[model samples]
Target: MPRAVLRARGALRRALPALLVYAGVRALGIAVLAVWGYWTGKSPHQLLSARWDSLWYARIAEDGYGYTLHLPGGKVHSDLAFFPLLPWLERGLSAVFPLSAGDAGLVVSAVSSLLAAWAVYLIGERLYGRRAGVALVALWAALPVGIVQSMAYSESLFTALAAWSLYAVLTGRWVWAGSFAALAGLTRPVGAAVVLAVWLGVLVALRQGKEHGERGEEAARPALPRMLLGAVLAPLGWLAYFAWVGVRTGGPTGYLDVQGGWGNGFDGGLAFGSFVAQRLFGPAFAAGLGLLVGVGLVLWLYAACVRQRQPLPLLGYAGAVLLLALTAKGYFGSKPRLMMPAFPLLLPLAVAAARARPVRAVLTVSTVVLVSAVYGAFWLNGSGPP
Candidate 1:
């Protein structure tokens, strides 16, 4: 066999456990969603493939952009607000196969989510150890919004690219890291996090090279040409899309204007703080408390990750994600899903699970998985993530 095939097989063998755990948790989430959807007279398939953002993606896939939705409240929502990569893939897939754009989106989501799980495992294994890798993937898979991974949304695609880009950065694969980061940038606005992380990784390499020391297999600075190329490629996807939007809207800051139409922007978390405070001091005390706790826990976990001295790329990406999630003016319910790509925040929890007694860890994971599954079902069946 070719050496590449052999290495691929070996990698698969090593990742099998993590893959299984990820698959199992995701399957449980989907099953719960399926049962709940049926009981509520809703189709799970429709919920996954045709609701909310999925419909917009499908519309963009079936008909090229030029769509502007005028809300009765005088708000104009443009299709240009969405990045193109997911709809591009959906269109290509639906054209090549006997699939609707929505089905193509679901297929893309399902496959990309598995790729994301694999990349998450590889990252944990690279930074910590094999057991921690398995734990990390499982923890990510059992998040309360885990059902989003199975939805026909760009989160799965963007996450797969971002995680793999981070993994490539850690391994010193400059070109691959930049290429994946570029694709991630094309997937969502949050792709900026991936680009920033890769740039930070490059900076780290440059600093290490100057110090005549290396970490991991990086014994010296990356080749100048490759490093430069990686840096150049990292931001092109986002810049290109933004430039295109600017040209289309005939304004240099067209993208920002589009986001403004949706009432989204960065305000350094002041808006989110007021939002939490209103709930905290209002009739919705319980819900507000839950939001406060959730945000606090996320922040605390990120602090733990930093204290643990995770790789610079991981820290950079997680910090960027957190900043965007907390500061962006949007639905608070989507913050968790927005931060979903910052898997490194779960490193502390994964390490804790790895250090526990086997049975105790299993029980803890099982309990969390059950709760997450039920919550996912209830979430999808209710107001639904915005």
Candidate 2:
């Protein structure tokens, strides 16, 4: 057999178990969704590909940008606010295949979600071990909004890019890290987290290099020029989209205006703070407490991640993701979905899971899977992702 064949076999042997875990968890979520659909007379496929942000993405894919709809309240929802990469993919896939843009979007999301799982597993495997990696993927798949990974949203694609970019940074593949980070920027606004990870990792490497030089030791410094090249490339995708939005909308901060039209923008979490305050004293008192608990859990997990000292890339990416998701105004219900890509935050849980008895770990994950699946179904049946 060829040496390449041996390498391929080895890789597959290692990846098979993690992939099985991912597939099993994903199947459980889908099965629950299917049951819910049967009970409610809803179509799971339509729920995944034809609603909410998915619709906007499909329109952009089919018709291109420069489209806008004025709502009854004088708000303009422009396709410009929806990033271009997903639609571009939808368009290309539809063109080359016998599929509608909606179908293509679903395909893109489905494929990307699996790639994201694989990348996530690789990251965990590298940091801890294969068992931890498998647990990490299982935990991620069991997130309450993990169903979005199978939808036509860009979250899955952005996550895949972000995970791979972080993995690249961890492995000292500076160019690959930068390239994926750039693609991530094209995929979602939160792509900045990936860029931050790359830059932070590179900065740390440079500092370590200086320390090694001072001690007359061989410095394994990441190549400054390559890392710089990646850093430069990482922001171009997002910046290019912003520049295009600005030019098209005839405003210097056109992208900001577009996001504002949708009642989204960074307001230092004031809106979120007020939201929590109103909820606490209002009819939704329990809901308010739940929100408080959720916020606390997010923070606690982040603190645990830091205590574990996972890596610079993981910490930077997870911190930036949480900050953006928490601080962004409006879309309170979507916050959980928004935070879905911060897989690093699950490292602490994965580590714990890895140490548990296999049967116990499986049972815990299975219960979460069932809960997440039901929640996803309930969410889709009601006011779904925005």
| Candidate maximizing TM-score | 1
**Candidate 2 per-residue C-alpha lDDT over 206-298 given as tens digits, one digit per residue, 9 for 90 to 100:** 777777785522445337778788888888888888888899989889999998888789998999989998989999999898999999999
Q: Model 2: residues >4 Å from true position, as ranges?
A: 1-12, 214-222
Q: Which portions of model 1 show Cα errors greater than 4 Å?
A: 213-222
- List TM-score per model, in order: 0.96, 0.95
Error of 2 at 207 (Å): 1.3
Output the TM-score of candidate 2.
Answer: 0.95
Candidate 2, pairs of clashing residues: none
